[model samples]
Target chain A: MSPTREEIAKLASSPAHEARLLCRHNLVDTTSGLAGDYVQANLVILPSAYADDFRMLCARNPVPCPILGATPVGNPKRIIPDACISSDKDDFDIRTDFPCYHVFSTIESDGKKKVIIEKKTNLLNDWTDDHIGFLIGCSFSFEQALSQRGLRLCHQEDNKVVAMYQTKIPLLPAGIFHGSGFVVSMRTFQPEEVELVRDITRPYLAAHGEPVAWGWDGAQSIGVEDINKVNYGDAQTIREGEIPVFWGCGVTPQFAVEKALERDAIKGTVMSHQPGRMLVTDWKIVDFLKYTQEQLGLSR
Target chain B: MSPTREEIAKLASSPAHEARLLCRHNLVDTTSGLAGDYVQANLVILPSAYADDFRMLCARNPVPCPILGATPVGNPKRIIPDACISSDKDDFDIRTDFPCYHVFSTIESDGKKKVIIEKKTNLLNDWTDDHIGFLIGCSFSFEQALSQRGLRLCHQEDNKVVAMYQTKIPLLPAGIFHGSGFVVSMRTFQPEEVELVRDITRPYLAAHGEPVAWGWDGAQSIGVEDINKVNYGDAQTIREGEIPVFWGCGVTPQFAVEKALERDAIKGTVMSHQPGRMLVTDWKIVDFLKYTQEQLGLSR
Candidate 1:
């Protein structure tokens, strides 16, 4: 069930620590519209053996797989504070922070490898010392930025998921992780406002930056077969004179991981956040940008 | 001795593939002024045991350690092409291509640990499968950009090494790598031209971005106690009305590795490119920026 506008506003204004408690206790079903000013990150946890290759994959495809930071080998506790959502909370555990998780694995049946997914509320039981948790930048950060600029998001207004599609755009292959293309989230903007939207969103490079494609031709260029049907998330209303705009999605790595598992490239379980549900962080979008610019040498 | 002006111009116009050949055959002692239109990189090699930690350290302090790309584990050949200087050459060997290298190690003497640096022309004998080669962005890329904008570099004109100093600015520590600050490369510009220089260099985020500090007070703020006495490279002439402008140097990781060795953080030999000698590559600075923008989500 979607929250009332008043409730949404209340959630948006809540401190990150309080919002985390709600999610940690399973009181919140989804992180959307919650802690609106705070940075929300997509979470991916991988075993130590595959960590380096995964890091390289993220490096290779930074738009879809922008890395916020990761845990050290065998350590579930995040030592680096800036990359983390909660800078002041030393006890923030990746295993129990997010609202939900999707665990992916592969099994052999009739001499064919098949992928399987299991959903969970937390990761306390599934985690191990060999696992490293990585936080990836989410479009929610830019969505918030866009919202502040008076650009209305139809999905948010109607209480639906941001439409996502698996495009034919091939990702740069990394070790044991290949054969997956980009997964882009779709939004709609009028033709006249498209350039303005691009200008506003381009600064959030860590949050997937500007739109990759827009308009009917843009959608076709990326090879989106059906506009109404989405691979993940729910489709939103498309007003007349408005065109669908696509931004690189965080679900990209998840799809890549699934592909790797199907190819038997990953030997162990891979965990990721359920779409739309994220780990709300203490960092604001502007502050995170400053952190990246000063510490990571990435400036607008 | 430095090359003559005609020789410098000829070297600058030479193709990256030819420049690499010159270095590979030991025909060139330094990469400076060679393949001026191409990208040059600083190399760092570490055992797999320490690569992840070192990678994290680089991530934590990116201005001083911007990663262009890295060789896969146990692979001496750089598989990633776009990050390579010779993007068209698949056989860009890390062990043999660089003009010079500095091998860092530790030894215990009189009950105290001491760090030692050894100079080598190649890594044929020292390299093993356990090593991972990382290509870090060098200041040379941005220096070329500055030169193109009519901002003359004193060191380049006089054929002197860019003066570098160890600064007191602390770096964020990672596993088994800590206790080191930043190393900055200094150039001089007139007081009125400092802002213009900053505007020019800011776009080269991979090449240490804009100046971290400028002017006499800027140098003092970063803890350059004696500007004339440089810690590495030659000190160039500081003309009247010109102020020292500092950018994060590639030597930073070298200093960090030395500090780690002193603290017994690293167990095996570490390798890096010698100051002033770089690995020339096929990528031009403008094209490299576009690659980062498209692939790495870093746009100017």
Candidate 2:
């Protein structure tokens, strides 16, 4: 029998074990709220031919695509040992860690380019020696941090994906990865909670950091035309006194990949973890704090 | 008549004016103590073929080589308009702004590859359409900050170049720019003032940040074999009750360039600003503080 939601939550306390359970059961749902306190990452796997440009892309658009770790070409193991797990019985595998994978392929149909997305349990048959994997920071890390401070996330309470939208702000272009604008995810909070939310999220620099914009007025500053209409994820109703807060979203890279395909800049297949299905790593929320401490030379 | 030191100091209060004066008179002396409160940079110009690898090198080894700005290929003007010069000049020529430049050439002799350094007033004849300029952060910015807080740098008092040493700590490799180790500049301070010094310098992330290691034992931790055998600059005596603190030095990238040439990873000339002849930028010391403020979302 499959594990219950409560059992999954309990198993999530141990990220490695939780990832194993999800992989073994081949669960296709989102990984949100599963591995509490541990770092969950958005995965992007590309052919080695496009690796350098994609690395530059992440470096140029750090806010939306903060790279936590990258594997060498043809390597499937995590950069850090046991950072991601496939199953309880097998070694950590990038192909099967996440609940589902989205494989994107560009095809020529009727003298026009069309993108086809295929959902698969793993990339076992699709894996190649020339593939490289990039694990990027997810805003879920900071969302958990905000929740700990008593700032309730409306989407989690309502059991829906956070609303995401494309913005007018253009990302700094690098190499062939150009022309794609910034994408953001939105949440609503009481007006009084904005400062506290910013304070709580700013420390997680690897995870998109603080809100790019707050309130409807601030949203328009970044050229968000409508709060109800979103480019990705489910839109939630804004309460009477709640303000709309926007943050750099992990979905931005997927959009950039699509843009690259449109321009014929990328020729091979590009793979990403399904929107809510993330690769759970061994890193804790406090690891970012530790990095800051080390940077400041406070720790031995 | 030549301007007095006081006149030059006063003139340096404005970076643009100082740059023009330096360019016109060809003042090839150390720029230290001239431009107070302004940021100084180490300049490196390479051919377009090697620009991407060099950029990756800077990204991978940020501590030793924090990039302040990079000019687009074939562009001699600063990346930010009027950011690096005083408009009071006849030209915004990068070739003649500093005291001197070091042009490195690779030569093969006796079945061994060797590097020859040539000192030039500018790269006037050497400038080409394929050259890209990289301005790296210099420690002088934070050193000035430390001086403001009553930390006396001994070498500055004696009018000598700061002592520098090459270490066994290998830098994170990027493409052809690999195999070079870290180089550090050492400063001595009384044991009681170590923490305060660390605290003051930690905020200047762009200018090498805090000390990588402190004291005699700490120096050994990073693989400094001997203190007396200096690699690049003048060595100062360690007074009783004083501890030696080491910080990342800008000289590292120059050393890396030489290493690259030795292995033939780099072809063609590599140009760099002569030691102590830095490119003064229009940025204030406090600009870095503002960056931190913005990163933390405290200034929004």
Candidate 3:
């Protein structure tokens, strides 16, 4: 039997492990509202040979691809002993903890490369001992903080996936992960409320920090031709006088993988969380922000 | 011919290209005083196979291994056309531009790995098409900014190389570059002047911004047993009431290379700039700081 609305709402405030269990059982379709206080991550898994280059790509373009933590080679368990974060002791499994995963594979025949993407309920069949997983910071990790400060996210109000778009801004190329552009998540805020929103989001550095651009002019500057259409997720209502603010999105690596496959740069399988469905990690947002601040030497 | 003191002083304020030419001729022993307004870089060159791991290692340890820029595979000419920083148009050659280079090769026989470090005037003899060079930011980039505010550095005052130490602080390892610890450069400051000194250096994010540790207790915490005995550079006098302040050093990568070789992780040669002898690039320090601020989304 399917869970009722009341049952799902109760799961929204549940602990991270409970939410993860829901995902493991394939009972949760989207992790956006579940475990609202815990950290949510975008998953990207690749062969160990390609892991270093992907890590560098994320490092070079930190705004678009902030890494919360990475799993050791052949290890799917989410445990970072020295991170001092809440997630260090969780009985987590990367392959089965997410509701859905997208797998991409490339085939080279007669000097031509073709990419095939397939959807799966879990990654158990595709995972290998030579693979490494990266948990990239997701914008959803900061949504709770915004709501606590009286800011209403358009997607949550409408019960839709956050709107994501591919932009003209190019990421710094690293190794074979080259020729990719930036991807951003969009939200509409009143002109007067934009500054307060920026102030609140600036502290969540791991969650893409402040908006990279805002206003109608801002959207055009990043080369988003149509605000009504998005590359991923659902579009939200843009009320009159409400400008769209764009923050770097974690979907960037997915786009990067596609671009790399198009250029024949990758020859193996790549896996990622389906957009809007994230891995509910044991980390608390506050702890992640504090850890990031200390790493950047911004802490007192 | 050896240049006079007055000529060397004049060369300090000269353009970056002129200073690079001096180093190209092996006329300058060290790049500390030359090109005061320009950026100086620590060089690390390795085979293409090891490039990704090294780059990821640097990314994971940003405080100790901030990358200024990287050269395209097999390209020794320093030209980053789209980097908007001052270095794009200069005729800079990485192999012959530094005063000296250190060549490290590993020999494996009978299941034993032996690392040999050799000194050379240039890298032309050993460099091949498979080599990719990385230019890392050096602390010297911020010394001018500190001096501009009337804060004198101890090493400069004594006309000695900055003291560097291998610390007990382990680095976040990546791929083959595992089991390495941090390396820090030391300087002494009066107790009251440390805060102001930190504020001046903090803005140079790419140049290993701010002190990682300070004072005598801070020294012991990082496992620096004796401040007077140095590992890579000369030690300066620590006056009474003054304490030693430590900054993340670029030498960490070299130490990382040593540790990796010791573990039988690397089987080929590694090339690096001789300590205190850096690559004087076309990039101005001011431009690099501004670019870094914009990238971090901290620019207004």
Candidate 4:
């Protein structure tokens, strides 16, 4: 059965500590369709100065790079008085919670043309006071939005990955971190309902409104041409009247970080699970704001 | 000079009689950047039955179709007693907002495609007692978020159209009305700032978070493979050390609506503007929500 608001709330409020531990221990591998209603995220940890720039970047770009919480300088859990919830009160450690980890290192002597992107394991030991843990929001939230709207998720049906592509769309960069553009994820829907789908999701982009494009033939779709060959997941079948829509993906930053992963920019930390897995905070946005409200003594 | 908060307030809070004048005499033109504080939306007047399904779709997807207000069947103004924003003093007609209009004829059929994907400009005379007007949030709101965050908009800077892309993502489909997946708009920023950009915007999309991808090597960025040949809008330059960031754009629905038009899903209606330009309302989100005290709601 699908998780309910009540069950999800309980998990967020209590036992979530164990829940994350369970996931980390591989006791719970698929957070994919579980412990929902709580916010999940994409994790990217880096050094402090880069952390500062990255934080600003998330601030500038927002939507994807949501920082759930940040650890203090050299401290694993930089305690924020009010987190989403208190149940499994986050020890605020980026070192754990995440079941999987990808530690990245940049090679100094590699020629620009011969550059290769590689990843290792976790980086708990080489911790620097400058390290920053950034938790980003995912399309998973949109998945919830879709489910609420009764839109069937094809990936669930096909038991496949959400089709993602590298779009020509460029992204905002900061500091020495000159990065490339985003690799957007795409989903298909009937052409007729395109507006209906757009109307429903756009405002949901935090009132920014949704979708950058729709209805255009997919064959010619590319911000920077020839990028279609690269993909993170397999593509799905496009129906007779189906129109493909593209969204900015979280991989945008990882690509950016890769470019900026200079020796000075060199820093490492554990990577979070796929976009589906999130650290359910004890706080719902409404309640999260309400809690912040009480803390600030908001009279109303 | 840029409009001030007080000036904007004065204009937004002006009596309906005067606000209507802005509509008349084509005064609302040069609306390129007006009332950035509030929402401006596309106005679509349609028959009531189609309105029902559209409403269902909107309700199903509140993110893109945030129903700020609606007009009664016979009411020329949306400030109807039974309307959503009945108390909003900005009660005005949708007829005059846009500089142009397009009327759809159910009989105007080109059997070739049986549907079309273009904006309708006029059809007020065809309005029946059963017509309804839809008010949706637009990209102007997020432009505020972007402009305030120091993420310079290439559009605003060059006085050009925002770069957009048509991609593989699809919108969620609805009855007679198909939906879209993710639509992305492009913006550029340096790499390190990417995280901050994402962080700032995450809370807003707490429901969905933000962009799906971030990339570094343009080739690997977006997981796709392209940029030069875009789906829409002119391409901009990426400076020596900058990365491009993508976000959800309001045009997602426009494509859907056009596709619907082409398909005759429900004779498209064109009253004024696109979905994202929200009608500046009497209430601001910050004033209504108490959580914006920090950083004065700018996320600085």
Q: Rate the local accuracy (lDDT) of all candidates.
A: 0.76, 0.73, 0.77, 0.50
Residue lDDT tens for model 3, A194-262: 778776776676777767677887788678989989998998898778889888888899988988887
Top-DockQ structure, candidate number: 4
As for candidate 4, its interface RMSD to one decimal place is: 12.0
Clashes of 3: 0
**lDDT of each residue in A1-300, candidate 4, tens digit only:** 434444544554355554555544444433444454555556676666566556645544544344455555566564343564366554445565655555655454755322244332334665566665666655544556666777766665676566666554444444445445555666677777666666565433321224545555443444523323436655666667666776556655676666665424544542433433345444443343344334322223
lDDT of 4 by residue, B1-300 (tens): 434444544655343233334543344432335555443444556666665555544443433344445666656556332432323445455655444444543345545444323343333454556677665544544556667887766666766555666543444344455634445556677788777776655433311224444544532444334655455555666666777666554445555555566566764343434322224443343332233224212223
Compose the digit string of candidate 2's lDDT tens values, residues B93-208: 57777678899887888887898889898788887888888888888888887888898887788787788888755554444665567788899999889878876875566777
Runs in model 2 deviating more than 4 A are: A1-300, B1-16, B23-28, B81-90, B296-300
Best by lDDT: 3
Q: Measured against the native two-chain assembly using Cα atoms, what DockQ does each of the candidate structures obtain, in the order listed?
A: 0.03, 0.02, 0.02, 0.04
Candidate 4: residue A31 lDDT (0-100): 49
Off by over 4 Å in 1: A1-300, B1-14, B79-91, B293-300
True-vs-predicted CA distance for residue B166, candidate 2, Å: 1.5
Off by over 4 Å in 4: A1-15, A24-40, A46-85, A90-92, A109-123, A126-131, A137-252, A259-300, B1-20, B27-91, B104-110, B113-252, B267-270, B274-299
Candidate 2 TM-score, C-alpha based: 0.54
lDDT of 2 by residue, A1-300 (tens): 987656865766465566645754676366667666777788888888876566655654566788888766787755533443323424467887778888998888887777788988888888788888888888887777787778888888888877888875555344456557678888899999987887677556677766766787778766788888888778887778998988777878887888888777886778988776777777777877577445422212
Model 1 interface RMSD over true interface Cα atoms = 17.0
- Candidate 3 error regions (>4 Å): A1-300, B1-14, B81-90, B107-112
Candidate 2: CAPRI quality band = incorrect
- Residue-level lDDT of model 3, residues B1-300, one tens digit each, is 765555654654347756766777788776776779888888888887887567656655677798777777888874443351243345567888888899997777678777778999889988888888888888888888888888778888888888889986655445567556778888888888877877677667677777767788778867898999888888888878889988888888998898888787775678999888887776778887787666543322
DockQ of 2: 0.02
User: CA RMSD for every model?
Assistant: 22.3, 22.5, 22.7, 10.6
